[model samples]
Target: MVKRKSPLRKFLFYFGLVIIASIILIPFYYMLIVSFHADYDPYKTSFNNLTLRNYAEIFGLIQSTEEAFFGDEITKRNLESINTKLERLKSISASKESYLTYVEETLIPEKEKELRNMIELIMDFSGLTPENREEYLQNAMKIGTKEYNEIMENAQIILSEGDITLLNDLYYFLNNYKSEEFLDKELAKVKEQINELEEQKQKIIAEKATEFPFLKYMKNSLMFAGLGALFSLIFAMLGGYAISRLRFRGKGMLQRSVLVVYLFGGTVIMVPLYQMAVKLGILSTPFGAGVYLIIVYIIQTLPVSLYMLGNYFRTIPYSIEEAAIIDGCTRMQTILKIIIPLSAPAIVTVYIYAFMIGWNEYLFASAFLGLKSYKDLFTLPIGLNAFSQSAHSVWGRLMAASLVSAVPIIIIFSLMEKYLTAGFTAGGVKE
Candidate 1:
């Protein structure tokens, strides 16, 4: 006998579904709103006005410059000296490689002259010559020694020292000086500057190298997701078949074991898995992280996948396999040709589920990968995390990144929703 759902019960069921749908969509809705909101403050709760400032900042269209003052001047001087040294090293290295070319080619002479002229122009603009360099050093020493002595002699004398008077003196000395001695001093200063530039360049290069991994993170993530999906689907097919068709001792137990894994909770395994990853030296490496993430996702998705496909497989009559065998088709051929085609909807469901699991995974990603600088190996989720941190809690940019991250998943699910729903429902209802 058939029974109709009570009006109140039906109303409650629809109301609950509406609530669940709203809950699922709230994050995405917030993400969209924030992405568009211009003045969304990360620090404040006040949402007074909307502005694109956060988005502009994230995209590097806007930036703040540090104001240079008297104190910063000394730091600037040191940086200039370091930069000069680095330039000299680069020139020396390049010259060493192209010594023969420099000696033989007219083009090389022209280029060298142009480079030398450019360097001289820069030095002139900065008021940095051999005389200036020497004067700067002399003033630096005098200020340090004299200031310390003055402070020690009578703390009140500190005010009497005045506002870096030595800097004015050094500037005057460079402005007035013009002799062979001055030229020699200038040449020596230029050489020192070149050496300093070389060192600064090397430091910059090292810093950039440190950030290289973050660049590759996206590529690695995509590769990992693709491979993980492929491997999981292949394995899930076999696991699903074993659970569905093969009658063996403990078959029911094996089916129930998958449910137990789901009940056990993913968080419980995180610590042990992380320890194993660290022990295996896979923590920092892309291959290790990718493989580990794949394993985690496969295990996490396996029970559901197996159960879903197993139920689908159960609906198929054994006579289909028998008829294939009568046609002289091998077991593998029969499964591939007959069974797989019939289970296309289920396979698609499992594929989508596995892909989504891989795409949205974060815990293993955060635990396995220590730094965000490994950009090359970043998945969309990891990239979004990095983008959020880079934005320094700016909600608009963070939401923008979040919105971008979700677009792919949304598109995928939207396209497969019908098939997925059908597969899920079919797996539940047996004829």
Candidate 2:
């Protein structure tokens, strides 16, 4: 029989654990807070000042709030001016003459201008037109049937495809300017637009998770790491099976030396690997750089993968394979249908380990993909590092990118943690 811990000891143990956990979590908390910041000012803790513009900027959505969604100063001023006049006209409950006079003089001109500017900004950002921002802004100032048609077509596309909800409402509001009931409809639409804009703003803020470059980098990373992990697992399974099952000359030496790749640090082999890549012309282009990275990742992961799976295959009872052979299964079929199924835990663990190595490898990735021509092929780690070193580097955005970069690995490790534990210790188990 075992005695339970006293209440005081229990409290202390839990209290210490809480403290340690808090310490570990503080940086993540800081990252979350700063990612919502409109600008980098750590001392400014006012809830009002926090914003999700950082995330938008990452996507290259708005160039200035660090980006915009009908949130720019000129747009804000125009909106305020029109809304004020609209309110005044509504409150007065004036006759047609008075209402028409006020609407014509104040609201219609600004609303028309607002519509034009809004469309131009929207189209420019949508990148549907070959025209640049300045060109589009200039075009936005002018209005013609051609411009209106283009705006309607492209703006429709933007509304259907884009995040901003205001464009549709704005188009409707501006269209109402042409109707006689436009005066009455104007007040209601403005209120609806304000509420809708606020809602859309909140939604965008919530999704401000990764930047545009990050998407491309993530794709590169996924391709390199994902393919590397898959092939490494395949080759490792083959090699590991041979080593564990078949008797051959120098088998013991081969088993012992399987981990020789890890004996010297990766740095020691970097020069040799670099020279090999250069000689093989694997780094000749960006696509070639990717191929090179994948090959290197396989090599990096294969030794341990082979060793782990070899041992784990040993833990799987030989009687199972014998049974498969007796049932007319081929040797390959026995390994696949029998060996692999029983060794699922070890297989998953080794695959994840291989993935982690490729996913997290920064040194070789940067070294190989660091050329200016290969910028698009830069993996997440390399891209994040470049962002941090750039002139526009902000702590908030950097932290956000770093956090996003870590998510895939965190999720994988969390899911496969049990397999990892079982696989690592399975070698010690006797049949």
Candidate 3:
């Protein structure tokens, strides 16, 4: 018989666990907060300033928008002034002629020569003869149905192919008129042009992010880590089963050798591993680095994975194997059908360990794949290392990158956590 824990003891144990959990989680919490807030200072925290801009910047959104909004600075500033003047006029009762006179004398002349020069430039670019310049200007000024269709068609083509600076000049020429009615009509057309340009920019932005090397690096990391984990799992399973069940000379020595290798930390073997990679001529290439890293990870993590699985295998009753053999199952078939099924939990545990080792092993990845020429081979760790070396560091962006690198590990572990507790059970069979 065993004595149950007292309620006080259980409460104390849970409280202690909570404290330790909080301690472990605080750094992650801080990192998440910093990732969303630019110029974050612990002493001056403000929730209102938290934004997704850092993430947008990382994924190429912010830069794309800026590029799309190019050539519109003067138009924006001049529009503000025009709006203010219009608002002032609204406060007073004035005849249409008075408004027109005010605009003609004050607004048009201020940028009239500038607008005319822009119009002449556009006419030359459009291959319109000088005689047709006056005709196009007349057509543009009419703000009629024919003018609308012609300008919209021509504007679309110009916007699609010409520099944005030309578009800006064209918008200013049409919209900076002295007539109130003309201003309103041209302003509407300008707004429509803005919308079309924005849509074109959106199309460009969609394809632009693929150009970012970090995205490629992330894909490479996922592929390499997955392959490494898969190979490691297989080797660990086979090595573990053989050592645990098969009779062979030097088997004990093999197990001891695994333990000895496992005891050796990564730092101790870094130099030798790099030397070996150079000797093998596997450095700097994606496939080469990937294969080398997978092998290294298997060697480094296999001992622990093997030890865990081997002990678990030893716990299964020998009678189960004997029964399988009596039923005419071969050794390989019995191990596959019986042992592996019973060892699912341990396998999952080992897989998670191996996957994490591959995914997050920064030192090896950086040393092996950290050449500027090996752009495709660069992993998240290497990307982050290079990003951090920029003269101006955006802590928010750095933290976001860190979070991106960590998410796969977090998700995999979270989903598979339940299976881990089922490993190495002694309840295989009983008589």
lDDT of all the models against the reference? 0.60, 0.71, 0.66
Clashes of 3: 0
| Model 3 lDDT per residue over 240-279, tens place | 8898899999888878865577557788899999999898
Best-matching candidate per TM-score: 2
* Every candidate's CA RMSD: 14.1, 16.7, 14.0
What residue pairs are clashing in model 3?
A: none
Q: In candidate 2, what are the lDDT values of residues 1-431, reduced to their tens digit?
A: 99899999999999999999999999989888877764644344543567776676565665433134223343345445655665664554445556566667777678667766677566666665644655654454444445556766666656654533555555555555556777666556655665665555444444332323767887888889889989999998998999999988888887776556657667988899888988988899878888888988888888788888998788888888898899999999988888898888788888888887887888889889985358778888888888777644567667667777777778877887787666557542111
Best by lDDT: 2
Error of 2 at 420 (Å): 2.0
Over the full model, what C-alpha lDDT does candidate 2 score relative to the true structure?
A: 0.71
TM-score of 2: 0.61
